[model samples]
Target chain A: MNHIFSFFVLGGIIAAAINGKIDVVTTAAMTAAGSAVQRAIALIGIVGLWMGIARVAEKSGLIDKLSHLIAPLFSWLFPSIPKNHPALGCILMNLSANILGFGNAATPFGLKAMQELQKLNNDPDTASEAMCTFLAINTSSVTLIPTTLIALRASAGSKNPSEIVGTVLFATTCSTITAIISDMIIRNLYRRRKYN
Target chain B: MTSEMLGESFSWFIPGLIFIVFLYGHIKGVRIFEVFIEGAQEGFIMAVKLIPYLIGIYISVGIFRESGAVDILVKLLSPILKVIKAPTDALLLSIIRSLSGPAALSMTMEIFDTHGPDSFIGRLASTMLGSSDTTFYIIAVYFGSVGIRKTRYSVLLGLLADFASFVASVYIVRKVFL
Candidate 1:
């Protein structure tokens, strides 16, 4: 994978150089680098702020209360996850972050959830049902506020930038439903394969 | 005037809500400050881990855009986009949308500035921004952090979802709203 990625980069640079677009390539690369830095800064700032809030929530038992409040919903969505597991907490945090449109922020929690799930798997070769379900949910998680999108819109200079709120809600809801349905179908297939 | 309009629109309400949530969470004994510090510290580490991959992705996107590859691809696909009744500008916009929200916003702003916000292109860009994901970064960081070696299906599925949202946004906005 690293080799392939390196090849792509090298090939792209060589191609650009041959085509006499090296300057353009360089500029584009610089712009991209600058943009990445900006994105990192924005994400770090936002995620840090939220993490603090989430910490407070955790310390205050709000996260626990939230877990309980949303447990039923989570159970329905992720039946494969054992009740009262550490993965459950991580999954909840991941979901909450997604809901807030903080994909960057949701990432570590999602990774932690996966790590916890990995520890529970008895077989090293195959992923457990819970892990698969969690991945699907995380990938297709619904986003409500889309803070990043709003920020982008604001930066882009859109008038009434928040106008896409309704559309985002509808689209993400659809994606989430699609993801859930697909996950169920796949899981069922895997179960039949294992048992039959 | 625009800022005033935005303020009048109660735009601050969401940020306020975020603040309230944070406060509530803190009050619940989360030790928000400490946890936040810990998380930020983690983020710093994550950023360092990502340096190599970030360099790769940024360079690739840069090359694509700079070598006129993006433009060539966009031009080639423009007719197809038109046939599908999607906006040409949005195809490129969506690609950049997730990589950098601010850049995407500025691009959208430029479109809106050049062509009035009510224009088809402007509306399409707006809708695209709302609907898409930042695919590469999400895959790189989240999947990388988890040490998931194979992302064969997830990446494909994510991009597909992004495509669906992009196409659907145009269709819904044009057919139903506009």
Candidate 2:
């Protein structure tokens, strides 16, 4: 994190000098902090609302029910996990929150899921097949509605702010399928290499 | 239902699902309001923790874009992009959207201002933004949070997914919007 952060900041300034856009860089630096604050504020309401809903769902056993309903599918995806593992439940809720565009709420659930998976890990330093698979799924999880994108479009006065929702659904669905397939293939290859 | 109507219905589905959960919690004898407040508080804390990360990434991306680095790359990549049938202006967006979320968003806003929001490029940008995650940022934070150092195939698969989404976004936008 530290390395990438400094590299981007320093590299950006150096590149700006070479491109004669040093002035632009200076101005961007001045406003960038404000933009971050604005971005964070933008997330508060959406995050808060979804967090509440997720809590309701979890406390009501809705998440557990949903997980059980999807257990057969999850079992295929995560064959190593027992059919009734808590990790399976966490993973389901995390994916559900992500699909609903509740990214902030999804993180805690995802982290909890990772932590639970970690407990099942035989190796501490290296990522397991399950962890890698989870990461892939989380990164490209299919989102049904992209609220942030829609809000941005609407605020920009687009006539049809929600028009791209279909496109997002299609694209994310494709990517998610890609993620899972590739993950399974790669994990199998790694397992083969380990045995060899 | 038509695809557009299906999309709109899904948009409403989230709120409806939440309401159902609320009612279910009430019937199940769970203290909905109290649990909700606790969860909201956790969300706020999560938001707070992300501030520094968000600021750092946004500023770096802003500087990079403003410094014309993005322009140089876009120009260099124009031929390949044209072959892919993607707009030249969207090159930066496709790359950065997988790298940093705020940076990509700022770029999206820039595109919206430069080209009207209804333009093909604008819709394409929005779609790309909506479809993908910041691969690097997610791997960093999630892996870092769990103290996992040796991330063997996670980054590779994540980038592949990002690439798939970018290609899918462009293809969908062309087929649907253009």
Candidate that scores best on lDDT:
2
Q: Which lDDT values do the candidates have, in the order given?
A: 0.63, 0.79
lDDT (Cα, tens digit) per residue for candidate 2, span A1-196: 4565576688788888988767888788878878877877776675666666666777788877877788899889988877766678789878887887877768767765776688888888788888898999888857887877877898899998888888999999999999999999999899999999
Q: Report per-candidate DockQ.
A: 0.36, 0.55
Per-model TM-score on C-alpha atoms: 0.72, 0.75
Chain B alone: TM-score in each candidate? Answer: 0.73, 0.64
| Interface RMSD per candidate (angstroms) | 4.6, 4.4
| lDDT per residue (tens digit) for residues B66-109 in model 2 | 77776776787788787778877667787787666767898899
lDDT: worst 10-residue window of model 1 chain B:
B1-10
Residue B135 lDDT in candidate 1: 62
* Candidates' chain A TM-scores: 0.67, 0.72
lDDT of model 1, residue B28 = 57
